[model samples]
Target chain A: MITVTGTFTVKKNKIEEFQTGTLELQNASLNTDKGCIEYKFHQQQDAPENFFVYEIWDEMASLELHGASQHFNKFSKLLEGNLDKELDIRIYNTI
Target chain B: MITVTGTFTVKKNKIEEFQTGTLELQNASLNTDKGCIEYKFHQQQDAPENFFVYEIWDEMASLELHGASQHFNKFSKLLEGNLDKELDIRIYNTI
Candidate 1:
């Protein structure tokens, strides 16, 4: 299984808007994709502008498919003007 | 690979304290255990009281072992007076 963990920092006042947009993209991916095991978003307690995205996939190929999908592309494009910092993405392979 | 994701709610004013204690425990586990792939803590953006623990292990047996280990037991006991709610834990097996 392949897991992708992402840490994102939204623009100071645009946190809610960013979350709404991102959640839609995530849910769309989850509902339509066959390989997605889990996709969850988390907000930081001490840092209101910080967000985390945790995703689990069946395999590396499935993850690659996800990256190529339209929803992911849309998510990437959507972040263009809304993010305060680049997304911090980490991929993990189950040992 | 086995992934255990946990969502924990710290008491109203204990977020910082909880984070400090939990991070120490997690670091200790990571340093000592060979089966641990990743053990991370996340705090939610919108929810300041919400904290998430994301852990990946080599297998279920390792996770079970972790549960029985001294550090985990100590962590469990330490939550007695500090937590506002029970730890929400979810386990995922790589497909």
Candidate 2:
């Protein structure tokens, strides 16, 4: 299995707006992808403006496919002007 | 299943040290807990200093148990002066 994690910084007070768009993108991605094991979004209680996206896929290929899918492209583009800072993304494997 | 996501902000340049401690704590937690399905940490490519911790447990109770465990407490304390900001923790359910 492969896991992809993204830590996003929404503009100081723009969390709600960002989440509205993010949820739509996440739901669409999860619903359409067979390789997705889990896709979840979280916000820290203490730092509400910071967000995290956690995803698990069946394999590296599945993850690559996810990156290449239309839904992700849409999501990526959606971040263009909405982010307070650049998105942080990382991939990992079971240790 | 219950998913716990934590967005942590390590001191601007303390990511490596934070991760070393985090990995040890995560390994200990996973090895000792039967309910832990997965525990993974990720750093974004665009923002390398940003980190996310994703965890899946069998249920909310299990997740609660994890939070009360020694490993977690140890990890929490370890973050005391090492963080640049407060930790972000959130819980989510599969929808």
Candidate 3:
């Protein structure tokens, strides 16, 4: 299994849009993607604009497919110019 | 519930020591701590020295207790000077 953690800092004015878009992507992955083991979104309690995405995929191929899914692609596009900086992404494996 | 993500970059010579200490801490939390919902440790696939600790607590009190636990304190001492830098910790709440 592979785990991915993405850190995003949303623009002050686009918080609502970013949240809605991420909710859509998260729901699709959890509900329809068979390879998705866990797909969760979180917001920093002290810093509301900071968002984090934690995902687990059963295989590399599944993760690749997830990135290519229409919902994900759409959300990615929707997020353009809505972030404070480029997404800081990290991928991990069981120790 | 509160979630915490901790990023640690280990010293090159102490990888084995750090892993063993973390494994001990992880096992103790999962097996003995009643309020620990999730206690997972992961290593970045592309960066062997980078470690990530993902934790979920049932309440703020649980997290506080966790930090004061004997096992956790012991492990923390074991890690002294074994890290490349101070741990980068992030706390979050569900969106």
Order of candidates by TM-score, top first?
Answer: 3, 2, 1
* TM-score versus the correct structure, for each prediction: 0.54, 0.60, 0.96
Error of 1 at A19 (Å): 1.6
User: What are the clashing pairs of model 3?
Assistant: none
Question: Which CAPRI level is candidate 3?
Answer: high
DockQ of 3: 0.85
lDDT per residue as tens, model 2, B1-95: 77787766678678778778778877987899769997877665455556677788998788888889898898889889877667877766432
lDDT by residue for model 1 over A1-95, one digit each (tens)? 66677777888888777678778877987998879998877666556677777888888788888888898898888788888878977665432
Quote fnat for model 2. 0.14
Query: Number of the top candidate by TM-score?
Result: 3
State the C-alpha lDDT per candidate: 0.76, 0.75, 0.89
DockQ of 2: 0.20
lDDT of candidate model 1 versus the reference: 0.76
lDDT of 1 at B36: 97
Lowest-sum lDDT 10-residue window in model 1 chain A: A86-95
lDDT digits (tens) for residues A1-95 of candidate 2? 77787777777767777677678768877898878987877675466677777788888788788788888898888778778768977776532
Which ranges in model 2 have alpha carbons more than 4 Å from their true place? A1-53, A56-95
